[model samples]
Target: MGAASVKPTSLPISELLSSRYPARVPRYQRAYAWNDTQVGDLIDDIKLLLPLPAGTRGHFYGGMVVIKITDSSEPSSNVYEIVDGQQRLATFCLLFAQIAARADELKDQADSQGDGEEAKKLAVLARGVRKSNLYYQRYDVDEGNESEQPRVRLSRVDDDFFQSLLDGTAGPPSRESHELLENAANLLRDELVTPATDATDLADARGKLQRLCDAVLLDSFVIHIVSDSRSSGYRLFSVLNDRGARLTVADLLRSHTLELLDDHASSREKAANLWDDILTEGADLVDDFLMTYYTSLTGKRAKREDLFDDVKDLIFSATKGRVEILAALQKMSGEVSTFKAIHAGMWPYVPSEHMQSVTEWQRSRLQRLVSTIQHKLSHPLLLAARAHSREDEFAKLVHMLELFALRYKNICGAHTGPAQAVYYAECKRLRGLTNGVAANFAALRKALNTLIDKRAPDPIFRNALKDKLRYDGGSPMKANLKELLTVLEDYRPWIKQGSSGQPRPSMINLIDLGQVSIEHIHPQKPEVIVPSLTSHTNRLGNLSYWAPSDNSAAGNKPFALKQPAYAASVVSFNQDLAELAAWDLSALEAREEQLIHDACLIFRP
Candidate 1:
């Protein structure tokens, strides 16, 4: 662990690629993931630079690339582990290979047409490009190995496919191959074969390709940073690449965790697979899951900027050995699905035997609570409770969480700063309980009452619902209001019973709410309005759900005209509109009071 020597210099893309030092992406690195967007951007950048003055020097193509130098006994060559910019290096190799392939194809065409001079010139250019940059020249190594391979080798997972692309023998990418690498190759091939803007004959195409090749090899430059060890390389990589088009917190964390487990390959693979499984849902969600998990375990908000540091601390502090660290990560990974299920509002179908005693009704309630509240503060609490608590205890826990979140944050408009810490602390407490489900359920209720100021009669929530419920137009709160109304509608005694003697809530087709739009009971711009009507137009009393088509049709219409649309609605809230004799301030107040009363009961803690 000696201090790493660092050197920074600008190198032409050609010198960087053609240098005797061969680049290798370590096995722990993620597979090549540059898709069409990235590939196209690089092409566009190079194409833009191609038309610049021939003498233009030091044109920056991209950010820095950091390599960890490795000792090679052979004097003729060197080997370096790619610490950063593997994507760019791999892509450059593919682009250059495609250019060489296109040049050779043009050479053969010219020779076939009896154009010997043109064919010879093309052949020389192609040979020079390939020989100088694309591959290693024959050399003897001290370890009895001879070198003659591609100048850039990808991570083991992608090396074979990358080599195939370099050799011009790749078929259409197989399902098993990395899609991004295939896409990058396809993008390069398409650009080389057919110019996007200007159609070119064989000669013009060759000229354009040669210009691109020259521009990339000679004109485009990168800031090359060479480090001596993996740790130094990673530090440099973070400093350089943490800015534009950056790696995510999860990416850096994944690399760090895998590096720690390097000596235990099987353990490393297990951790890697678990990480992949977490990402399989979506790459962006891993950070979210981690943040939630971290908050739950530590009872502190995990900032994205500090996520890697915090995770490293947690892993190392929990256990010093790699085996213990891997075991801890495996345990954390196992809980990922539960968080994911909760995030997706799919707790009912999570397929865990622990959830078997939890009824569909309870799951439905949990889903509604999560979807409506739409906050992350309660996720850790709920997830930890689900993992450690029994079904009945989990049901009670979800109820307490739903009440607190909806009442305190949603309706009361309280900031989540205090609540997040409390919820996280509760998560830890729940995890520690021996009879966690039942014991923690009581603990959560008591904590909510103490920390959030749970009043005996709960007048604070009811008053807040009445006074602060006015949703701003086009705000997310307006949507939350509609969802609240739907939940209240379902809770009404009017819901019909099924043959099984249970309330058939599914009869309402709540999925339609996803498409339904909120409408003003009192027209937004009424043709006839009594005094004080203007003030009440956007209040909760004035709003009801309507189908989009119906809402549009009822636009600015008088109450009498809009009554027919309300009468045809299935919502219990809308049905009350049919009985209204007039759309006046009194009517608005009456409806508002009734709705508020229902809400107080529906969201009662």
Candidate 2:
């Protein structure tokens, strides 16, 4: 299992897919997940590198395949378990199959045209594609019948579908094929067969198609690392994928966590089930959930590169016994569900029936706040508060967090590093309170307020907000601008009632709204007549939400001309702007004061 035992070599994609080394995907590995985007990216890379001269060796497609050699004695027909790079290998095969199909069509066309020499050359390419090492391999069985079989065998789930696709026998994608696999196959087919916009004749098209097929099969290469044992295979998998797209942290963690439960079959099964449940959303989300979970657990940000090591350390440090480790993993798995619910805006949908005290309204408010702030640092705090606090306490905690995040991040324009550290420390404090004592909502709020007051005191926040309004132009970050606009537009007095007999907020759900741009009420261009309003164009007073279409339509128009469009608008913010008679500096100043006043109450800490 040492590094020295791992054999690394480079081989042309043609040889790698050839009968000399047939690859198999083990049952434990995930099914093929490469979609149109990934397949397209690979094709684009190959096309970009196709112009390189022969023997130009170091052009990388950004991946390595690690295989465990099963039979060293039979070098020509060696069987190896594909430990990594199954996605790339499978995609390559699919792409080549499409190329081969195109070549066959071209050969037929050459025959019909009665061009003997061209047809002969086309036939050679067609045969090379059909008989390449990628297509078939020979296996030595007990019956001594050496028959050629599919070169690569996938897990049971996708083997038949993939083989049928490679052989061109699968008429349209069937239900048996995974959607991603179907997408890859169809995308490659369209890319290869569709004529380019330049409109080449059949002969020229066939020649170009043949050249591309040769480039991919003969010029492209993959760094192949073969390990003699499974242990070495896993090691090489980890090492090589650390730099490429082959394996992710979640994949590595799954392997490590399963190994930890080697002695307990039931625990191992349960753990695997938990892993699958978390990944049912998507494998990419596991890293996000884990990073947030780790931050909440330890009040420290975990870098992506060090995330696996950090989790390993955390697991080892939390418990040495298998039972304790299993319990911790189970708890973390539950936390992942909670995290997912929060991210999906399903706060009221608690998995535990007993933990449904948080009402849907409160959950919606928290969702709005998270969307407004657009930061993940507050996630750990929110997850912990939801788990431990009463509905009222959780509501208060959400308000405090919203105010703190908006003030520090949006108004003050503070550095995120310090704010993250502050939030992480508060998360640690809240966790300490919950674990050390019975759930004390009052104590948790008190502790949180104390920290918030120290870090972002009311006076400081108010001064910062006023200063930002007076001096700051529009927000640099679109999220911050949107958050500010949402707050201002949605603000309403408690006494107001809508047609439904509820609070008539201007904007109920900003999260689901279509694209909105910050429109200038008083045009910034010099042609638009205004009294001392040019310097204040980017201020909050001058900004209002406009649909991108409306924004473009109203571009640089004088305020008098724009007012008609604003009067026709539906947004309360724009309607209010239409009521204004003048577009002077005094009007801008008045609007600024009113907005600052509303902001003070909305963002009050």
Candidate 3:
């Protein structure tokens, strides 16, 4: 395609709505999910900085916020595929639904819901939402099986997130229809309805929302990038992003670190070459060496999470190259050992799955290790590791990981087995060793192992160690591992620490821990219909963790249908029980507060 063009305009982006995607473009084309918080942050920005002012420039710091679009051949239609702002658009529609539902109650409270006329004007603005809007076509798969056909057709979301917006739906429509109405209803609330009603007191707040939308035109700038292909786009995207403060992984990989050469093409070319070289994985080896060298001097870090900044620090202290870098990598072994020694206090508590009880300790260790490695390059132990020994250290560490990986593969094979106990034992053993080179091996082993357990140490517990952490960007390893570990936890007893603080004393209580088949608090499938657990998404508080067996039994059964099972398994559904008891309303009403009231507590740390 030719270079994409940028032209901003202000209208009631309200009328701008129409199907804007190629009908054939499939969900797989953009197969991913965005949670409520990400959506919430957008609204927060809109609200906090009304007229979402030219708050920040887009091209200067580009961020791809994807949206789904469809084209409808309707008269009086707007046809434009969402280019850069899909995430916010989709989420705003959802939030608008919540705001519309609460219009009447919120009429009195301005900050909470804006003014009264804004609410009414919004109602007038968003009349036939259910039929016109297409977001409401939600269905549940099945109750017992994941691959089953749908049972309940209209079910859009699980009890929590779905029920939330429904609580305070203000008017003539059924809760579902009213919600659909709110999707566009919010646009009216923000752009036209609310601001018009305000004279002075609400002057600023009233037009604020609408003004924010319009700001994108005047304030938002475009890159109008010239890239030949997807690869170029990816690299350009990363390069532009890294130049800003909020650097991403791809940014670290793409960043040139030199000042932008708007004036000097030669300088730009030089910088690009250096960046391309370092971005290579082999360059990561160089990066490691540099980090060891720098951390040897100052105290800093270089982790993927904070790699861009860390890389910045290490490169700043460039001690020549080849000779110095090789020297630094050689010395890195000792530096790793020293770093480990400094953070040893956090080890005992660490061998456990999470460090909830030791947040300070863990965060501190994370910071220190990052700092120690990248800054303290010449430290004696590192010098040895750097001297042709970096590869050996890398290999030794790799072997330990391979062993652990093999064990992980085995545990995953046995669904409902006690994977946590095995993992914990391995961690403790690794931590106890303190040899110079071996410690680095052990440290690497421990770090990698920690990554897995973080996602699912004891499956029953809610620690979601990320899949992206260990598997080197492949499939969803954590999800698969969780499924595997769940099996072990189901069949085995609780794995606890021995008096000697070992992981394998006995199996006492707890399900193959958190391992088991997918539990549908509200199951969906061909035969068994349950509430739409995944639909009408709100904060995940609505989606409680459940065992597959329990989830299956609860399928399609309204709380009423599942009452007997609920009574029988009262002990098993701790979170669901606590939440229902807290809400005090068995059948949900049209009150946003109820959902918020019940949910806010469960969601926060």
Candidate 4:
């Protein structure tokens, strides 16, 4: 525990990976958790150091704390457990594996070209500078010890999959960690290969690839802090994480809660497992979930930076001991899935066992609507309602929220302040109903209805739907237009159905509408047009969904020339357009009126 017992050394990854002392990410540690952004950022940073000189050092890759788990004096006999820096270390291993693979591929190309000298050079690069930099040999004669092991061995959960990344035999990911690992490998491989694969000059590409390898292995450095024992390493890990520059709310909260449970090893271990499960389940939404989960439980709006303090306040106020704290965490763990489901627009449908009565259309509707609007403020309320209400009741709550977001936020362009206040208040009220009685649901529904009616009155909503819903070239309007057309297509009576009466496939996909274009029925820039109809060209009635090809081909042609394209289209919106006898202001106004009526009826609370 003394400063004398701890030793820290600054070394390049080349020295670390080339050393006989192997590093191991403990089984209980979290899996390789960096997402695509972090992985890409690391590669991009290294790319800045490209064309590295022979003896020049590149960027410092920060630090890691590892405990000497074995007491053996020989390096080969000792193993270091990674208490911190698993993500970085694992990422580097992945980087090296990809570079090695790229080098071997080039070597194969050289061999096929009958260039023995280039082939030999690439083979050395593939094997690394030393014979065993990527996978060091264990010199210990212990019968149980394997002859060769990866310099950085990941946890048991990801070790096999990590190996598959090196060998290039990975299949679909069965879990989140597996997916992350695969993504990192794929991203790194793509970056490493693109230059070499695209180069016309083989020697230049090979030199660049060599510099990349050297930049990673010889230039990038980390301060390797060696600890005397696991406990000491863990204490240092806690200190480093608390003061780390990139410390997150999840990190701070986890460290504080675990430190509080340190007295009971059993409770601490159980809590650690539960924490990992919740983090994995939350995935990229971990921070968002922390804020929303806290808000939902307390019915108070919490900022991300202030979340740890807010959570600590709750912990001190509500819990007395480790058991009580653990119980509180267990309850929080139960709600993580609900938060994830809500963010994914799945809600009651995710836990399908408990939500048997929730129909597929209901789930799809929420999913589509959520994708079309900014539903961040609605999360806390949705989480609270899902926790307190039954499936049927929660379905009603989701519909109410969707209508509010679509009408008030998306179409009417209302300010978010008033809506946020109403949502937070309802969240608090719903959380107060611990037993979730019928009267409580009724009250919440009534309040929500009143808010919706007040914010998005019939006349205001109808006018917006008819006029403001037109395409204005902004992404928000484009999304709103797509949402409107997709809903109309879903409600169209002519849509084909199965023998089982399930609705036909939708003409436009609400989730990903990038390929679908909003066609101007009246022609925005017509080759021939009546002067009076020019002003009505951008009306909601003038727009309908068209495939990119049809939109390009129509090309400002008059409705006469566009009629054949519309008649050939399968989209119900276009089919409706084909039925029109001629293009005029009267027809556009009539269609806009009918659309307004249908939208009002379909989105009714």
Candidate 5:
């Protein structure tokens, strides 16, 4: 328990690491995987390394290989961590596989026509190289030891792109966006993987590259923080979070304060101290601390990253120093009779309609009614709302206001942070209710956390929305963007004016209106299923993304419906979201031109 020893020294990569050493996986680092090009190019590099010019000799693989090392303490074995260069190691294994494959191919071609004894000898060496590929080994998911063998697997991104590039059949867009993918594909095709002339040399190079990569990169001098105890390591782990990119909104805000308050040096120190004091003060559960902070904001329902720019005070964090916590304390304590004057700057962004329900005089009366009990219950109330949304799946206790509303004067009392914490725990345990009280609260509280934490909802889910909503094939607007823009230009007057004659900014960008395509639930006449036309017609109502693709395929039949031998052509339905207050799909059949015209209006700035 005394101060433990601490030291860091760089050793030759191999000397620093033990065979089994793996870095203490940083909390933010993703799991191991290598893309096809990295893997594919690596194999090709070994085949060509000997022939390459001296200037480019080490260029393929020299970078700082950092890892942390821990000595065998009183209890555990010595350990080393790989901080960088994982991809290089994995790629080396891939090179081994390709070298092996090329050797076998050469041997077979030579043997088939009795070309020479060299072909037979080459086959043997290729097998040896192929057998050494540890990272590419197929995953034996359930067998823990089988996966550790030398092999490589191409990443999902690499496989698809390489296949397309090699085939030369993927005619993707010519736009700025598609340019990168095409370039990457072209690079892989040209630089990665080559024809092998001598199977034996190719085989030798693979093994050498594999051993070199494993020794230098995997075993290299990477920095790992270590102490004598396991628990101490856990404490050090917290610093990794503090320093890493997986920062919470609160963490970002904490960092932002420094930049914002720098102007007034004294106030800057004050802001830093005050903010931490408030965060530490009467801390409930960490989650609730986040909820309380977010509940105090405007646009409480939007994503956090979306709204982080509104933090103007962040620019002044240096001046605010510890005093910045005053903003939070004022926001929280302002409802009391003693603090009315403190809130002159806080009210405009307050969203609750009920904030208007309490006047200064009434706040004073409420304060007198419960001198010791806090009257402000919004923080805990928001937790209750979140629990309610979860169908009481997470209900832990009665909300603070709900407790107060219990109607027995003696039992109905305002709750403290500690008491609220207990109630939150109770709500987490609350049971089934059909009224959705639990669910409503659950979603709202989640929204509160998003407001506070400030991260984007995962992009995976957003892309999933595109597929679910069927915005993939073509534009929901005109098939071509230029033509569609021309059509939209004709409706400028209809779009630009709002009800009050002021120019209303457009909502067209909310979803990509341009990319939407009009799909037919029914196939083209020859393909249309004849049996249930009525049920099918309404189902095939056309929809599109708010962006590039629009109603190009409207009234066109799906191809499969006519050829019964082929699969029955059912239309891939878009989610059919309402662009207007009362937009419906029937408009696609009758108001086609008008629909396009109206949809374009949604995007006007």
Candidate 6:
């Protein structure tokens, strides 16, 4: 049950796959995640050996760690659970599948050309490649019943998709991992047939494919590390990682947490599966989720490099026994759906008795406001509030956060350090709060409003709104500017009447309009430049959202010429601009003043 059962053996990939035991990536293992760069690099390295002389020493492909999951010793009866190097092994399987299929295509071409000898040679090469692929990828478990099992079985999350790739039945990828797998397959195909190496005939192509197949199957080497127990396998995996092997923060956390579980094998496996589900849900953002979740609970900053250490400390400090530790993780997993909804800028409807009072509109508005601002510093606070506070309190918290962000982040250009400190403090408080605390909301509002007044007072916001705000398409100010204009568009409709002095049209979600573009009221390249007003061309007061076609047609035109398009626009902000008396410095200043005043009122915390 420990280190004595661990064994290490060096083997070429050929021997490793040709063994009787079929390799299985345990359910807890992460899915195939090699990007195009990694896949291309591996292929390039393998291709480097093709030009070398025959019978050269095999290239070292690194280690593959596995554990014998079953005790049966009969041929093909044992399953080696892959603990590490699945990425490399899965990638090799993909490459072999492509080679076999390409060889088959070449064989078919030769047969059609009436070249019996070439066809026979290609058919044999195809079969050889197919056999190697079967050893690494899939083969029949029962010859009589024709039941088959993959030699290197991927996790349940990806086994089906990986199989489809080998069988050439994969459609467009439906998830991030699937996309990476598809990209890897496509990259291997590209490397297999480059422009410089493309053959002129079926025979030459067959030769080229055979060379690649041989290079892969006969020339690659790996250190096959085996263990008889899961705990030993994980310990070996961690030791290898500590010795400079690359593993992600999420991977380390999962491994460390599982290592702490002093339980039966079934319980350990269940915990591993639960961790995988959480990891899979987080996907690329798993590390961020871990950091934010831990920091929210602890009221301390968790850097990316120190995430595992922080979580480990928190686990030890918060739990007293094995059951409590597992429950702690289960509680953390429950918040994943909420975190995902916030990350995606969408309000998820989780049915709960306390959530019935929280209307969809309020939730939608909260999400839209945060999304428009696009700030991650607010995520931990929001996540903590959702987890600890009642649904209505969470809604109120969102509104306060939106106002603070609009003034402090969007308008006044302040550093995130100050706001992050306040947010973290609030998150810590929220994490400890019981349900239905009206006094906490009052204290939170006071703290946020106080911070707003200090960081982005009316005078500061006015000064920044006057001229410091500028946005070209490529500038980072584009998001803030869009958020400002969208809010103004909404605000203007409520306060101003229609063209016929009737009620204003209902407010629109200007940010979501597909064709909307930020148009300059005083065009960037006007027909006749007013020297006094040229400096104000890209200012906040000079910009409004317009349809792309209208923005284009009115480009660089004078105020009078642009007035017709603005008047016909659907946006209230644009329509109001059409009512200006003249396109002069005085007019720009007056409008700027009005906007500054309204912005202060609209965004005041």
Q: List model 3 lDDT by residue over 394-449, tens digit each.
A: 23332233223323332222231233343333334433444553534454445545
For candidate 5, which ten residues in a row score worst on lDDT? Answer: 405-414
In candidate 6 the C-alpha lDDT for residue 531 amounts to: 89
Q: Give the TM-scores of the predictions, in the order they appear.
A: 0.76, 0.69, 0.28, 0.74, 0.31, 0.86
lDDT of 5 at 475: 39
Writing each residue's lDDT as its tens digit, candidate 5 over 1-605 gives 23444343444333322333433322222223344555455445544544543324332243322233465430124443333344454334334444455556666766775766757566666654544333223334345434332222222223333234322455763332134445444433235434323234533544443443443333333343345443343334334444323434443444455334435566545555544443332222222344433433331332344333334243233344345444643433332211221121122113343344334322222221122222344343333333233312222112223223211121112224433443344334332334534343444344333322232122322222222222233432123222223223323444645324532323122222223333333433424354444333322133322223333333444433222311222211222222222223454443344443343223221
Best model per TM-score: 6
Q: After superposition, how far is residue 330 of candidate 1 from its true place, in Å?
A: 1.3
Q: Arrange candidates by lDDT, descending.
A: 6, 4, 1, 2, 5, 3
Q: Candidate 6, residues 269-311: lDDT per residue as tens digits?
A: 7777777677764355777787788888978888876666677
TM-score of 5: 0.31
lDDT of 2 by residue, 525-558 (tens): 7465665777777776777777544544766888
Which model scores highest in lDDT? 6
Q: What C-alpha lDDT does candidate 4 achieve relative to the native structure? A: 0.72
Evaluation by TM-score, superior candidate among 1 and 3: 1
Stretches of candidate 2 above 4 Å error? 2-15, 18-21, 30-78, 107-149, 154-225, 239-247, 258-284, 316-361, 386-396, 415-422, 429-463, 470-472, 475-491, 494-595
Measured on C-alpha atoms, candidate 2 has an lDDT of: 0.66
Model 6 stretches with alpha carbons more than 4 Å out: 1-4, 136-148, 193-197, 201-203, 243-245, 258-269, 281-283, 316-326, 350-371, 390-392, 435-440, 471-474, 493-515, 528-531, 547-557, 561-580
User: Cα lDDT of all candidates, in order?
Assistant: 0.69, 0.66, 0.34, 0.72, 0.35, 0.73
Displacement of residue 523 (Cα, Å) in model 3 is 66
Off by over 4 Å in 5: 1-29, 32-56, 60-83, 127-148, 151-191, 195-605
In candidate 6 the C-alpha lDDT for residue 124 amounts to 88
Query: lDDT by residue for model 1 over 327-361, one digit each (tens)?
Result: 77778777788887888777633455545555666
RMSD of 5: 21.0
Model 1: which ten-residue window has the lowest total lDDT? 495-504
